[model samples]
Target chain A: MVTVLFFAAAKEAAGMELLRLEVSQSLSLLQLQQRVLQLVPALQPLQSLLLWAVNNQYAVPAQVIESGDTVACFPPVSGG
Target chain B: MIQLTDQPLDYAAITESVRDPAAGAVVLFLGTVREFTAGQQTEQLEYEAYREMALASLQQLVQEAASMYPLVKVAVVHRLGVLQLTDVAVAIAVSTPHRAQAFAAGQWLIDTLKQRVPIWKREHYVDGRVQWQHPSQEAAVAPVVGEAS
Candidate 1:
């Protein structure tokens, strides 16, 4: 299972801070994004602007996301 | 030292934490909650972070800055939760053997953190409107600004 976290505007869009999704095996982040949207469609509007992280590190859509990892969805950072 | 906190930021403590006897200069930078954006009055701001990632990103920035400037010590703290205008929302401190190095490292740390950290800010205007501040989502949430609160 992958623990998916949402932060900032993305959290508001998703309407929850986080959720756990069961994954049969490792999948690419792009594929995971699709699966997540299937479960949380509210995030669709913000998809283009979202940033993704896997296991606390920035990852590309093609990067593998294994079960038991933590995936984060957020917008471009604006922290000082 | 790097952290994300819901409590008020103690910038003086952050600066002191990075002080090193062997370093000739220390530089500090604080990002405060501003009162205005454009002509609209800002009542306050709320900060949020993807905790684990934000902390890791801050540590990486410190390490990167150290590699670039020979930093003696570094501390960064970013405030989460609500903050009123003029409150310090973030603080970064670095000590180096020279003033130039310290200043350069301090600037780089703040600039890089803003771009790479997994933290976000929500602006609350005096008119009761709220907006989230992603670089591209500047106008995403709120209606047009009106008279101040």
Candidate 2:
């Protein structure tokens, strides 16, 4: 299980701040994104521009995520 | 390079921190919470962030700026939680061997961090309304005039 966190608009839209998804070691970020979309279809369109960070460092879509990782998903940053 | 605390930033201390015998110039920039945005009369602003990520991004921004300029040191600190109007939201300091690089690199780091960092600010209006200010996508990779970068 990996802890997934959402922030800003993503948090407001989903009405949730975090999620823990259970998947095998072979699962990649893309598959996790798909699983998140299944859980919250309203966020599907954000998949492309959104950024994924595993344990606070940025990661690519194909990166394999470890089970204990704390994964954070952020919308295209609207800061500054 | 260093960034610390969400409390009110001390500009003088930040400036002093980067002073060195070899450094000829230092540039300090502070972003304050303003009284208004668009048309709303903002009473306060609330800032939140994934703290660890925010710090990493800030460190990366300073490193990038240092590499691009002859800067001897850099420090960036951003506040979190509730902030009143006119409260300091962020502070950035850069010291370089020359004034030109100090000024230029200081501006660049602010711009890039504003565009790429995940910090969010929510505005509280005088009438009790609240709104989230979203950064423009087009300028995320480009500099916009008068942008708090």
Determine the backbone clash count of candidate 2.
2
Q: How would the docking of model 2 be graded? A: acceptable
Lowest lDDT block of 10, candidate 2 chain A: A42-51
Q: What does candidate 1 score on TM?
A: 0.92
lDDT string for model 2 (A10-40, tens) is 7777679999988776588778888887998
DockQ, in order, for the candidates?
0.42, 0.38
Residue A66 in candidate 2, Cα distance off native in Å: 2.7
- The per-prediction tally of clashing pairs is 0, 2
Q: Is the docking of candidate 1 incorrect, acceptable, medium or high quality?
A: acceptable
Q: In candidate 1, what are the lDDT values of residues B1-149, reduced to their tens digit?
A: 89899999888889889888889999999999889778989999998888887887777777767668988999999999999989999998899999999988889888878778878888999999999888746533221112111
Please give the CA lDDT of all the candidate structures. Answer: 0.84, 0.77
- lDDT score at residue B8, model 1, on the 0-100 scale: 94
